[model samples]
Target: MKRTAEKVLSVISLVFTVLSVIGSFIFVAIMKTFTEGTLRTEIEMELYADPELTVEDVDMILSVLEYFEGFSWFIVVVLVISLIATIIGMIFMWNEKNPKLAGIMFIVAGLFAFILSPTSIMLYIAAILCFTRKPPLAAEDQSFIDNQYDDSMRPL
Candidate 1:
């Protein structure tokens, strides 16, 4: 049961991780184009009618926008890193080795997967499952346990 659960959860996590990586990259690319060209003009035109605003204020605002663009790129970098971490976590989950560490990696990925907020939430759930799930019994051990159970249940 735990093996099945872990496999399902790991596959789901991979799907979400891919979605998040693609979405984050697309969003950043679109935002970069918009901010570099149309956004500045839109902002200036929108603020043009304000009587209290001066040229310097507009300049400051555009500068701030530039800073925000840089910040967004930084976020994209973090998102990429988070995606990598998520893949690593998925690998660990699939191999069924060091689940506690895998859970921690998932948690870290979740923290950094901010662009697609739901992905982070899903990753967190996956992490929780990883941490709480029981390890699967070896096949021979499982067969032995089954035989013992059968003997115990027999009429004597």
Candidate 2:
């Protein structure tokens, strides 16, 4: 059993997961810079252009930017773990060993698959294929059966 499709999907998922982790880092850096920069103050002033904007609301918005940046590290860590799981699954499938366990690993990785629907979808499909696919049944040789019949000589 080659498991070509599953292998391809897993590799693709691994790449996507890596990209997602890198993107998370970039996102956190950008958010941190935005929070600390004068642009934030400019944006605050712009929002205050609307006389209806209250001090509490402005403070909440500023705090949210910082919190989002803080939480992005958690996202990066999750994505890294997901990448590791995906790689382990790929290795198992590549060697055509322990496919059921590989599928289970994929499912576990899919739990936090980097917030990318396509990547997660690919992982899930790979898992399903691993679980449901089976090798073709072995066929007995006809020539051997004929030789056995000739030796027996008596038939019902």
Candidate 3:
């Protein structure tokens, strides 16, 4: 029932979060390798043609590399943070505790995922499920309620 659903949701969230993190790293690596290769080729061409590249030219190349590296790191950081938040939300949801807060965290994570990751849709669904459902009652509480009902129904 609700417990089974929660378990399934939490496991899916964990799986998706891990996949998103891995995908983010792969993306950054691919972009870095491609850009660096192109820059290297351009630098080699300039050096070959000029036979004496200027300091300013080197500085410009370095600046471009620095800018792109910074941008890539920023994207990675944001994606990682978002995935981490989703993981935390999954943990909270699994425990059946602080569901409202878990839902909010999942929403935030989903938004961040939308910006730069692939798990946005799944995370959004998880968030919605969290928000709409109430936690299942404890077994003891249910048993107590059942005993009270039985006592009332018995003959005097």
Candidate 4:
């Protein structure tokens, strides 16, 4: 049985997952730099001029950046997990071997990374295809199929 659609979907989903991982790393890097760099000092200098802004507010903003930056690493971890699942599924799919297992992996990975829309959507569709597609039944010989003889076992 051919698994072209499943293969395509899995590859696309993998690509999207990879992109998401890269994006998360980029975001984390930017956040780290912002918190550690002179830009933070610049922001503090500007904020000090405001009459209503308290130290607590500035600290809160910085803390938020720190928290979310760490949080982005979690996102990367999730994406990497999904990426591994998809790769396994692709391996099974490409060989037309154990499609059901591949489908399961695809679905699990998709739901696991549901926050990543593109990755999840492609995997979901691919999984649907994998689960639904079936191999054609083998053709029977016409003579055997049309035989008129009674082949039933008889008790003499």
Candidate 5:
């Protein structure tokens, strides 16, 4: 049952990681379009719609967008890092050799992606469950391993 759960979690993580990469790519494209295309016109229309608006108001809004444009690459870098971390974590989980650690890494990576990507919450929950649940190691098998390693070196 635990192995089944771990497999499910690994699948979920893999899906989320792929989605994160796609989402990041989409975000970058959208941001590029916004900066280079109709966003300025939209902002100008909105500002001018108010009868009290002045040149300074338009300048302020354009300046803010310019500032955002300058930092857009930074956002891209962050999303790329998140995508890589999530993919690596999913691969580790799928191997199932160290699921607890892999699950933890996945959860952390998912959370990071979720904050910026908003679509990774599902993966984060699955990873959390995998980390919290007891693995399917049988008691007898655990005891055998314990004896081989000696009690002092055994995991509690």
Candidate 6:
């Protein structure tokens, strides 16, 4: 039963991990396109609409946008790193070892991804459950412990 539980948890973790990685990549790509395309155009238009705004103001605004663009790249890098972590966690879970910690790490990563995009919330919840639920040990492994070294041997 315990082995079965472990296998179940492993499958769950693997599924969620893959989801998180794919979601992260898609989110980062979409965000980058939006920021570079529509968002940049909007900012430029906003600056142009204000004729009273001096050249210094426009320069400052552009500078800010440039900084934002740079920061957005950092977010993409973070997403890549998160994808790697999720993959590692999936591998650990599939092995049916002490993957609880790995599962928890993946859950936290998924939560971070969720903050960036709500689509990742499902993966976050699934990974959390995978980490928290204790897997039952194999029957043979638990029999000795479960039997309590024979009830008859107990001191009355």
Which candidate number has the best lDDT? 2
Model 4 global lDDT (CA atoms, 0 to 1): 0.84
> Model 2 Cα displacement at 13 (Å)?
1.2
Candidate 6: Cα lDDT at 143: 42
Greater lDDT among 3 and 4 belongs to: 4
- lDDT for position 58 in model 3: 67
lDDT of 5 at 93: 64
Alpha-carbon lDDT, every model: 0.75, 0.85, 0.70, 0.84, 0.64, 0.61
Candidate 5 Cα misplacement greater than 4 A, ranges: 1-27, 33-52, 116-118, 139-156
TM-score against native, each model: 0.67, 0.79, 0.60, 0.84, 0.59, 0.53
Ranking by TM-score: 4, 2, 1, 3, 5, 6
Tens-place lDDT per residue, model 6, 1-59, is 13444445445544655565566567656556645877768877888789999878987
Please give the distance, in angstroms, between residue 31's alpha carbon in candidate 5 and its true position after superposition: 4.0
Candidate 1's TM-score reads: 0.67
For 114-147, candidate 4 gives per-residue lDDT tens digits of 6458779889889889889998789866775654
The reply for model 3, stretches above 4 Å from the true place, is: 1-10, 30-67, 115-118, 135-156
Clashing pairs in 2: none
Candidate 6 versus truth, CA RMSD in Å, comes to 7.1
Task: Count backbone overlaps in model 6.
Answer: 1
Per-residue lDDT for 6-118 in model 1, tens only?
A: 55665676677677667767767766775777776887888776889998897787787677678777877887878788888877777777788888888898888773577
User: In candidate 1, which residue pairs clash?
Assistant: none
Candidate with best TM-score? 4
Clashing pairs in 4: none
RMSD of 3: 7.8
The sequence of per-residue lDDT tens digits that candidate 5 reaches over residues 1-156 is 445654665566556656655765676676666667677688678887888878898778778777776666665565566566666666666666676776676666666664544435655665777678775676564444435654577666
